[model samples]
Target: MIPYEEIKVPVAGGELAAVRWPAGDPDAPVVVALHGITANALSWGPVARLLAGRVTLVAPDLRGRAGSSGLPGPYGIAAHADDIAALTEALGLDRVVLAGHSMGAFVAVVAAVRHPERFGPLLLVDGGIGFPAPTHLSPDELMTAVIGPAMDRLSMTFADRAAYRAFWQAHPAFAGAWSDEVDAYIQRDLTGGEPAMHSTCRIEAVRTDGIGLFDEEVLSAVRKLPVEATLLWAARGLMDEEQGLYDEKRLAAADLDGTRLEPVAVRDVNHYTVLTGDRGGREIADRLVAYARA
Candidate 1:
């Protein structure tokens, strides 16, 4: 495993738990990464390893997830965006490469727009663009429908860490893509003692942020990105389904005309693997290196 350090980033109410993979060179570019709604900072482990110390990688467990779970909410995409901006300022970073995956992509979009001067190019992995949701469903129902099992897992109690690992082992998305990095990512989400362990993600935070996926704030932000963004979409979806989240049809409907977003399809990887699997991690790492060097 690549060496990393866990640190706390001071935000409004409390500290956001984060991990840093230091670059070999002190002046190397920095990439500030964000994780999915139910995921923690460790979710970026695979990509961090792939980077091989070429550039500094910093990933935060956004408020209400993992180490930041104690941080009170007002949690939503906008709140998370503001936290990211503050994080950059606190770290003394001018403009850094911004990247997000899943729900994180949404956060990244809002951050870049609200604080455009804080970020360079964006790397959106399988998220950011808003898709239509069923209008009849309530906020909770909408989250259940869109996020599916990930939301369900938030309320579950596990027998042990092994049980939680088994739970994810059964997920279709990780069928053949499981690795040490993936295992480490999931392990970090567990909390409490044996026979009663549960995920560290706060349900309120997930619910609030999940609703923001369809909010106009996110869509408007996507349409107003100040820097160029490369969207890396997976071939498969959250559950390794045939239809991935964003396709040409959905892209055409989003009307990305005035934005600097470019869509790039990544083959043979599902939504989860797009950041965890070797192929996906390498692709993302390559772009990060190029962007960092440029």
Candidate 2:
């Protein structure tokens, strides 16, 4: 049986929603799985099922994402890291296996470094240490090029759940990778409003948090984490040219001596789907369990 429980965790000066799945025994080692931007705890459903019998899985909706609400400003990597630390402390957990996808990966890396005493290992799925592209274009041009339909999504409203689902179905990001798990994820992230399903994530949070993100200071700090660490990245091109996180050369330069690097060559999987796709989920979860055991 899949042990599922909802938990309210206080962190970073606010309370967040978290789900902990005790895999067979509560005494098993815990793995904290964090989702990427625009995703919530449900993103880990597929992976969680695969590891359900081995490790206790703790998945939390980061502040301002999904059920975790009422957060103040300064919603950057540091803030998210603090939230993780607070959640672990509030739950009385230690020696955890830290894992994250995409933006969530960066958050986990920062948190593990900031609170090295609390975790034993780190597994980064498709992100961490650095991201690609800085986007030298103007803000308007950058938004149009990168965010695409999301710009319209920010202003437009969905008449019903169906409409919202349809919008997601047509989105380029999905690229025919949609599944029941992905569908459920979109549903939970949108709210029914007068004429549309609106996203709960604050637009300002994206603009402010993504701005001025990444630097040598951040990379240096992450390299100092006191635990086993591994990075599982998709071979497909995902990081933009400006982010500096996806470059094979740069990633090689990030070598911290003994950090394991695994390139997931699974078919048709890209940066986004590495953590969101079904096949990728199983692969990531299995690797995470192995990392946790180490």
**Candidate 1: misplaced stretches above 4 Å?**
none
lDDT of 1 by residue, 169-250 (tens): 9999999888888888999999999889999999999999998888888867887889999999999999999999988888
Question: Which candidate leads in lDDT?
Answer: 1
Could you tell me every candidate's TM-score relative to the true structure? 0.98, 0.85
Against the correct fold, how does model 2 do in TM-score? 0.85
Q: Could you give candidate 2's per-residue lDDT for residues 1-294 as a string of tens digits?
A: 244788887675668898777788767778898987667887777677778568888899888777874576668777788889888888788878889887777788788878888876888887776643455877555545544455556556788888888988876557777877778777777875757568766666555444424545455556567776777776564432233235567666666455443433444567767777766778887887787777
Model 2 bad stretches (over 4 Å): 1-3, 131-152, 237-247, 253-267
lDDT of 1 at 259: 80
